[model samples]
Target: MTSNSLFDNTETAFKLKSDSELERAYFLFKMISKEPLVKIGTAVTKFALNINLPVEGLIRSTVFDHFCGGVNEKDCMSTVDKLFDAGVASVLDFSVEGKEEDEQFDSTAEKVIELTKFAKNKEAMPFSVFKPTGFGRFKIWQKITENQHLTDAEKLEWKRIEDRYDLVSKEAHDSNIRLLIDGEESWMQDAADSLCEKMMEKYNTERPIVFNTLQCYRWDRLEYLKELHQRAKNKGYKLGFKIVRGAYMEKENERAAEKGYKTPICESKKATDDNFNEIMKYIMDNLNDIELFIGTHNESSNYLAMDLMKEKGISRSDDRVWFGQLFGMSDHITFNLGAEGYNVAKYIPFGPVKDVMPYLIRRAEENTSVAGQTSRELTLLKKEKERRKL
Candidate 1:
């Protein structure tokens, strides 16, 4: 705990009701910091073996309890109600990932639409999101992005993707539920962006019903934000942009090297941060032209948003912009900002323990990979504990 925090009457922290939450967050932080928990490398590595060694039980108790609303919609009743009591809402993300087979792709899209149905008539969950990879095989997605020729079978596979998206978007539009399309790896992102833009064109006319995630860590996305905004303007539709720093930095650079192409990453944290805040400013300056969601844990970036809201003369609760943090890591930011009456939502992804494993592995790696993220979480937890004298 910082001495400053102690004197600031850390009792204010109590209002967050995060004492127990911090304990769980801290434990997970320490546990995931170890290499054994964040498995990667050759598909059949020790990490993979270790993940299967009955650790699912432990993960369900700790991370699932803290992060997920639940594995299924009905199961989320308790968490949803609890968050509502705290003046926060949820963004339901069904976290089933990585299926190479077509049947698996089709099933994921079906589940996404089903999840949307489950959320209909439900007030607490305002939005539902899908990854384009959920609808198309990764290899097929790669082919489509490169504009390379594909076999007859591949064209059929691509059409199935279009059907899945049309099905999901129809349900979302009909139910009046917002759709958030998550960004993918750099290699396959062009297709994701194109599909998301197509949906936004169809659904985001008067209001932003389809939101596309922009990963600002890519050197070009800041400018792309403006380009997309301009396209939306020319085409006469509202633009929905969710600004995130990015997710697949390591894999992106690695693949670039393998393919012998220039890396698309921003090249430095400063550049990424600069681009991130710049995009935020751009969207804020044109709020009527766009809806913005700031999906980041960087404090400065988060505050930059608050500053923008003030400068634009918009209230904290104005729906034009939303502040988001992942499920467990930034409760202080999420809850505090929500407490201040800013529009906020937690990216609440849930699924069967086994189905969500890859997501968990990335999460474990995220806390460690993002510079100081682990220690920053620890420091907050440690502060709350000392304040509670626990």
Candidate 2:
């Protein structure tokens, strides 16, 4: 291999300096970028794997080392403290799976409430994050959101969802722990966004204690953000939104094409990027109306927002905005921003091994779905290995 320095010409970054860490990212990039459909099938199977495989051990050592906090709450905090020491905050996520049973729903709610209590006094754990599906069933949400009539039990189930969030949000409100709800599949998103807006109305009276995530991959979301911002202004309440380009790109397109509907997703990557940056500017321009979370892995996009902020004379420490990347993928952005005195956090997910497999598989596939060069990580590994040799 040529003597290519991975860190060359790069301003400061918090990436692997050791050969071992570099090697792990290189291999993980391959695993995650496996053909999309095949990877999902494999992920579902592996997610259900009861028999241990060699790959699982590789996982514990590689991407898991980079991404997940741990299998338990306390175990998760090791990274929290580490990032906190480096001036970064952590989001406490239970990483609960989407389940249909009432018991599971109740358990997830209790866990989040307990997590909120634990995070209340912690300076590093700034937000309590969870998926709505983690606390309810997807099919029911689909039905309710589609305006289809529901059975009495189905209606009752929806009520339970409201009640569960009420409990969790009440704790967050009383304890002053910020709550963030993750976005999900396009089919069930109407319910998720509506429920989140309701929570925003309920708890966001005094401040942005609850935030709804907006996935900008969809063409409509830019318009959606404008509407949301207007609603926040009209209601005289602060809006909290975490903006992401989105994760389910392929799935969203395939489903729409299969169903013979106009795809809700942007027609091209450029369109999505265009919308994402536009929404970023709109939010940054109206900082007093909203608290924005820049949740993304794209370096150009991160710098675009930051540059815009600087142009507008927005302080890096302005509590109105935040920067976030998943725990594992882009320490380059997360740690560097932290070092620059920006409010940054990693979305730290923690749960039992079985429950976190889906998240892990997505992490694996995400590394693959992008540009195939994969050369950056490869270069990093080779350099670190070379550095160690010298």
Candidate 3:
């Protein structure tokens, strides 16, 4: 049996962080713990950026440096090397959001392809990730999800989107790097899911080179997983999934209310947790045809995954399973798992400061809204600080 106190070891967790870095983490989490301060801070930062004020340096030095690896692939190498030194891998995430142009979509797709090539032959980076909306217009995805008729121009636009997906998937397959396609809001997710399924069918013949994100906050994800599994099995293709409780909870709930439709989200936090665990268990049960990437900051869920691996007698360094957390947050969980010799990776988001603000703001808000997340981070940081003193 794995020790229940495994994650309580702050020494292993913070060994890579210097005293100044630890203090900055403590201060950041302390500020994020205050909901009001986060709200005010987010607004002020957005406004300052909107006016093109001189806050990029300030933002980059604080939250940007803390949360992100750096502004580009070249800049992120130092952070990736540090993580690999601690036996953790990095997934370089280009986190620029909300682009609506075809050229921008092409650029984003090219970036993913470039990152895949960059990760080639590098043991430190086994994966690359991109958001669906980053490669196509959101309205096109929503229209396809809603099954509405599209104009010829829209058809051409969507064809380009498919080409982008194919381009990236092929690159990942050839480069031998796993690619994760992130989940988006429910209204547009159906189309994204369809596209990802197509990619998996084409590229996952030998192994899982492409992964689809499953936001388990949605009550239907377990059923979706089962259906997808059946389809993959029938077609004799592998499957890969990265499961998270989800982002965009408030946006999802608000949209359901506005549209007068049943909310897709689970009824409560407990329900979401159960759904996540149930889906995770399903993936664990079928590791032969399906690979698993468990992306979560929840300690209990991490423990459950570890326990399941133990029960199944899977090796600690199995290539078919990986545990992932974001770069700045969840150091305790990531580092502890790494110490135990589990396959661990950190999703290291990087982009220009202005372009990556949406991603960073969402992270801060998520830390504030997820009950006890900020406090847990604070407690661990404090414990590490005290340990250093002793």
Every model's TM-score:
0.91, 0.90, 0.99
**CA deviation > 4 Å runs, candidate 3:** none
lDDT of 3 by residue, 1-390 (tens): 678898889998988899999999999999999999999999999999999999999999899999999999899999999899999999999999999999999999999999999999999999989999999999999999999999999999999999999999999999999999999999999999999999999999999999999999999999999999999999989999999999999999999999999999999999999999999999999999899999999999999999999999989999999999999998999999998999999999999999999999999999988999999999999998988899
How far in Å is the alpha carbon of 19 misplaced in model 3? 0.5
What's the lDDT for candidate 2? 0.79
Per-residue lDDT over 1-390 for candidate 2, one digit per residue giving the tens place of the 0 to 100 score: 212232242234444234565566666655554576546655555744656555656556665666688888889877788788888899977875757899999999999999999999998988888888988999988887888899998899999998998898889899898888889888989988888888888889889888888889899997888898789778877888899988888898899999999888988989998999998998898888888999987767888877888889999899888999887666666777887788999998888766787776666666667674245555544554565567
State the C-alpha lDDT per candidate.
0.79, 0.79, 0.95
Candidate 1, 1-390: lDDT as tens digits? 112222223344235455676677778777666665555321333355456777567667877777676778677777777776677778878898887888888878888888788778877777889998888888887888899999998888888898898889889888888888899888888887898889889887878888899999998987788888889999999988888999998998898899899999988999999989998898899999888889998877887778778877988888888888887767767777776688888888888877776786677676677877777767777777886775
On TM-score, the stronger of 2 and 3 is: 3
Clashing pairs in 2: 32-364, 32-365, 33-368
RMSD of candidate 3 to the true fold? 0.7
* Candidate 3 TM-score to native: 0.99
Winner by TM-score: 3
Best by lDDT: 3
